[model samples]
Target: MDATPPGWPEAVRPPGAPDWERTAVAWLFDLVPPDYRAHEVLRRYPVLLARFARDHVAAGLEAARSGWRTVRVELADHLPADAMAAAMTAYEREGARLAAAARGVAVVSAALRGERWVPRL
Candidate 1:
């Protein structure tokens, strides 16, 4: 029986499980820019790292959504019809991926904050 909530990242073990925080930190780091790895403060403070990861994921999700909303208007004239359609499809796929990443980040952030998931019937 897995205790992890839906959308919980596979890279992170369930909260309260052995080494879960360490795994969570590693997983969170993977979500952020590679440059974030150079920050000693973020590495020393997992909670702070989680916060940064949350914000970063949120920004990515927003960017994807914004691009999807405007790509047609911005590129319709410049791109062929098939290319424009492909761009829209690309945006939609990326937006969905980012949205899922956002959810995973939220769950990891909550766990890092000491929140535990309790399954309900």
Candidate 2:
């Protein structure tokens, strides 16, 4: 009976479930830098925290993509073929992870902003 969209983070309960917002806040905090937890405003404002998480995830995704694009060219002479292959693999994995995180953050942020999801036919 879970109504959450695909890519919804397992750590965040479905919106409107008991203590969901608290769970969401905790999940969102995990996406941002550790230093972000020190900001009282972010702790007090879940919506803002969600925005921060979204931005952080987006930046990470972009960074991974950029690295993937340039790593082979930038390090071709500096590293062996095995190391280059590993760097490409790392970037690919990170891009996928951040893409999922971005999706989860988007839905969580929408929920925090009072937007509810209705089932579609």
Candidate 3:
């Protein structure tokens, strides 16, 4: 069974779909070992993931507000437990999906750009 939680279909896609940079990050993450991914996530704690997602979205909105796409940092991990857990899970699931999607998108984008996907050393 696909471990994707509810609303995954709608949430997985970034607002404008995967941009080149995000697509690249997604691709890079795919080549990373599963154990490495788990280690990184555990190191950061699930709460950090949720906070990062919130800050990222808020930064995007703030950028729009100022007619720029720059993101600013805010206090992190202060959100309530229930909401934070939900957000964290959603973010984790979406991150995994995006990584896989990015690999696919990278291939397409590379073909369009007349390049090939090159894994970083």
Best by lDDT: 2
Extract clashing residue pairs from model 2.
none
What's the alpha carbon RMSD for model 2? Answer: 1.0
Candidate numbers, best TM-score first, in rank order: 2, 1, 3
Worst 10 residues of 1 by lDDT: 1-10
Compose the digit string of candidate 3's lDDT tens values, residues 6-102: 2232223322344533443443334344454555772344333333333444444343444321112221356566765565565556555544443
TM values, all candidates: 0.91, 0.96, 0.29
Off by over 4 Å in 3: 1-78, 113-121
lDDT of each residue in 5-71, candidate 2, tens digit only: 7778999999989999999999999898999999999999999999888889999999999999998
Query: Tens digit of lDDT per residue, candidate 1, span 1-121?
Result: 4498889988888888788889988998998999999999999989999889888988888888898899888888899999988888988998888788788888888878888888899
| CA displacement after TM-score superposition, residue 107 of candidate 2 (Å) | 0.3
* Each model's lDDT: 0.87, 0.92, 0.40
Q: What would you estimate as the lDDT of candidate 2?
A: 0.92
